[model samples]
Target: MLNIADTLHRWCREERPFALATVVKVRGSAPLPVGTSVAVDEDGNAVGSISGGCVEGAVYELCRQVLDDRGAPQRARFGYSDDDAFAVGLTCGGELDVLVQRVDPGTRPYLATALADVVEGRPAAVAQVVEGPEELLGGMLCVDAAGGIRHGPLTGVLRREVGAQAWSLLRAGRTARAEVGGDAETCPERLSVLVHVHASRPRMLIFGAVDFAAALSQAGRFLGYQVTVCDARPVFATAARFPHADEIVVDWPHRYLEQAEVDTRTAVCVLTHDAKFDIPLLRLALGLPVGYVGAMGSRRTHDERLRLLSEAGVPEGQLARLRSPIGLDLGARTPEETAISITAEIVSRTNRATGLPLSALAGPIHAGTSS
Candidate 1:
């Protein structure tokens, strides 16, 4: 489990065996999404959780059973029981398919290597066979960002196909299932693989050295973003100014962004109200494939910035991507509050949320499992 990677890695290094119960699939109303896991050691010590509280006891007992017997990997399903209220199930009315498996260096040598990558902050994904032949039940393969297969089986065409799928899911930072039928030449079995991805932290590039940028850096870090604060002024872009930023660049905003490694998950925030910095930086950011691009300014400033960008030959579609007069309609005043507003907008956009109050909407609070 990437969430408790440090603890798992520690156990692996100590040669302490543990049984892991991971939620491989969810049907509806689940408290946690796929890849949520709970690991139990031989001494009855546990780490992590599969359900918030609903089906934890059942899952823990399953883990203990696996540990006690040193048994083969097994899958258990849990859901609400209408007839029996006291049944061992999820009262939340969701269905979870959990895979319980034992882990140790001797049995799964690849696990230690995969855990090392996760703990060291590298992008990695563990593809485990959730449904397949008995022999391949717990087989796992590790795929890194570079498309290298660090460990596990499925050779030849099967390996290439699974690796490509794992890489795609890893890039999207999604833990999902992939099905593969019998490849006549490579293999002859229908399998369901659960790809548990541990993608690197997304980037949050704050293009300014103002107080707002400082506050935003902290908020971005809190949201698991690799925050970088950049400005042309050396004094303002120092580490002392942006203590929470993972990187502080003293280069021109546009220049630094031009060489920055931006992906679809990256968020670019132009906090510099100055046209000299904002215009050039936005011109480059809007055209890139970054997730969110917002600028801090007033209504008049936003209009002026748009006109300037149009004059600079920015396409209308690209200009439409800009979120000027940034942040939601929250009447935030202080820098800290404004930072919350900005990060909230970034999260809302990323998650495709409506940014509305939950009470105002009518439906399941947790709709889809993407986020």
Candidate 2:
């Protein structure tokens, strides 16, 4: 898991043996996603979480069993059923497929490199045999963004196939299980491998140094975003104003955005509330393939800004991408509440959610990866 990479890497460096339980698959309204993990040592110490404290006790015991047996990795299923809803069942009414395996650096050296990549925010993926023969259990293959195989034991066709699958998952920024070696004419025994992708944190560029930007910076950091606060005025863009921002730039917003590396996962928040900065920055941001672009202003200010941009020759299609008077309606008045509303809007947009109350909904509380 990305959250526990540092702790796991430390355990590996200390040569301490431990058991790692990963949520390989989930059904219905699961608490965590597919790549969530929990690590437990022999002394009953634990790191990370698999179900946000819903099914952790059961998974922890399962980890203990794997550590005690020192055998092939085991798969455990936890769910909520009417017959056993109160017996180690998830309150979220979801099913989780967990794979527990021993992490011994002496045997699985590739884990160290994978953990390092995760800790250092390098794009990488780890492919592990989740279901196969005893001899193949715990077998791992790691691939980085540069098409480099850091460590792997598989060779020939199988190695090539797994490497390609790992790369595909890395590009998709998802974790999934794939079936391998299922050609009945040649090899009848099929193997299931789980690929865990560790992509770099998404970027959140806040083009303002106002009080709202400081609160938004902290919120962005909490959501695992590499936040950057930029403004032309160096005196107002001091690090002390927004300590949570990953980067503070004393340059024009549009100029900084022109040189920034933004992807489909990146988000741009224009809190400048000024036409001079907003027009130029919104022009560049709306043309890019970023995930979100929102500007903060009153309705009157937004209308005037739109008219200015229209006069500047920005197309109507590009103008539609700008979310002026940004953030959802939550009756927010304070800076912290406003930050929460803005971040909530970003999360809902990224997840394709309706930003509706869960009690009013009927389907899964947590959106699926495909959603």
Candidate 3:
């Protein structure tokens, strides 16, 4: 996918006319988060997506019209309601307000900066929410590399402190809430700054460097992971076999993870099932904050490994974190199929989604809150 903001900035800088479709507000089971944007140039070439695929066609038609009309920012709202309202709304039963605007002077500069940060992988995307006066709730902001704030509207001590807090959320690539009401009071609409953080992609530290490791490394890259395969056996750890991996290190697994470090953003998959290789590495991996830790093995093999881990004093809490049977219960029989199931589980776990279908579930399709 193209950088939606970058595409807009190019059109603006080239003195060419273009239109941008941005998600301004969302209520009731929205698919894409608010502030999602895409640019359609005068020639009808478009970049980025707004909904899963629902609203883009309509949003594009609106863009073609806006290219000729020059004025202040224009806003459009889209929603789904069983109760008839507008003729146009999402059929998925969610409400979203889309702000489509000409790439005019008003937003050209601000959008340019925002897209610059995103294209360069600068870690966050934030926007200002210009809602009316005293009802002039502050706005949103995001974090940067040095843990600094990018967008800000709140003022004084609270502003300064919350900016720092907002950066923390951005670093983790999550949306968060921060109180912007000057006093210790909390307001429902107190600058509900939706901090959009771009957590660095998870690092795949593949141990063993075997045929399975090679396949898993490729699979990891396909899934947008920064794959790194490492093994102390230099013969097996050659870069030729794993061209897709970002780093192929001939290093010990335990020492490599210890030094390179793994956070909640990292994913460690132990492909080397040999006890001498997998055990010590498992000991180190279990202690880290990685989101997904999967080790390839049969149920019988995993049980043995678990017993050994318990004997090694690896603590029940930490031991419980490992996905021993590795992937989900997909009954995968091949390396390719197994890799898919494993990665699917990892993605589902990262987004806090169960391995269940939306149709089977009862209420709304959100990870946490219900309306």
Candidate 4:
């Protein structure tokens, strides 16, 4: 499958006409979650994003003109680091780069197919940006869930194998990078693939629409989760309350879990303190392949919940999957702080980490650069 970059290239070649936006660099806290992308078509149409509505407008204009000129791919950059952003009228003041190119239909047939596949739920594609002009720009592999590697302008058996590994990652809804070992004596530098895994955007199913849930949804969005909030009361589940949430469902907690698709990449968090809502939801959450299942309460509440579940025929082994007292022991007192603790726990699970502080631990936080 064609990675996002290659897909744009291929589409442009086909004369379909699209824009390409890329995160070139990030500094400080950063507005855009890096690797965020946005594109536009010839008729001032767009898909994806570069920043939080900051530079996307100007970038789209460039794309509109660039689509008409298929001479060569052009790279456009915007950033807070530059004095130029004020002139462009970007409020967020974040840094971004956009590549506007006309795609080749014949050469990028695979990319076009991959783009279609993603929209149709054929699974994501992994792509490798190898031998590019700069450091972060080169040898980069972006793997979709299925692990198919999209290697650009690079060829050989290694490319095939690595691309296949990328494909596997894409299909699996995981991200990974592969480095080719064998190289000729003349070519000393082994192919170093900077693997960037793009799984299906994680689903954050939040079971409460309380104040805490808003912060929790924001935290989840920061982690790239497609956030959703559930509250049986329609009054609470309004767009005004959860501005960050991608979705808000007013339905029974357990029913929502049963009806909505839950997968391994999904996370379910129960913020409601009420036993009436949480217990049923917990039962449903434990049954799925979801990566994380957490419920908010105290140690006493946790014990009581366990006792109730035991009475309901849930075994101890199954009950162990529930994070009853929910969140790491971060000594968080407020809803926002508590939200951070919960999200931290989710990251621990995602990275398969032990949830220890860097001061207490040693070695790299990231497990491997390429896998």
Model 1: per-residue Cα lDDT over 1-371, one tens digit each: 67688889889888899998888888767788888889999999999987888888988898999988887998999989999999988877878889999887566667788889999988889888888888878778888878788657566777777787788899898778898767686458988888989998899999989999989999999999999999999988899888899999999999999999989899999998999999999999999999999999999999999999999999999999998899998999999999999999999999788899878986555576622
| 127-211: candidate 3 lDDT, tens digit per residue | 3443422433323344456766544445455456666666766666565444354345433344444344555666777787877
Higher-ranked by TM-score: 1 or 2? 1
Q: Write the per-residue lDDT of candidate 4 for residues 1-371, one digit (tens) a residue.
A: 22354546545456675545554334323454434566666666677665567666777777677677755556666646455535663354434444455544455555555555555554555354432433323333333444545545545665675576666655456543345534563133555443334456779999989999999999999988999999999999999999999999999999889989777778899988788998788877887788899999889998999888788777777798898688999999898999999999988887788898866875433333211
Worst 10 residues of 1 by lDDT: 362-371
Predicted structure with the largest lDDT when compared to the true one: 1
lDDT of 2: 0.87
lDDT head-to-head 1 vs 2, winner: 1
TM-score of 3: 0.82
What is every candidate's alpha-carbon RMSD to the true fold?
2.1, 3.0, 4.0, 8.8
TM-score of each: 0.93, 0.87, 0.82, 0.60
**Candidate 3, which segments miss by more than 4 Å at Cα?**
1-3, 12-20, 24-31, 40-47, 57-77, 81-86, 99-111, 130-142, 150-162, 175-179, 182-189, 365-371
Look at candidate 2 and tell me the lDDT of residue 18: 93
Tens digit per residue, CA lDDT, model 2, 135-170:
776678999888677667676677777888888888
Q: What lDDT is obtained when candidate 1 is compared to the true structure?
A: 0.87
Off by more than 4 A, model 2: 42-45, 131-137, 171-192, 310-313, 369-371
How many clashes show up per model?
Answer: 0, 0, 2, 34
**Relative to the unseen true structure, what is the C-alpha lDDT of residue 112 in candidate 2, on a scale of 0 to 100?**
86
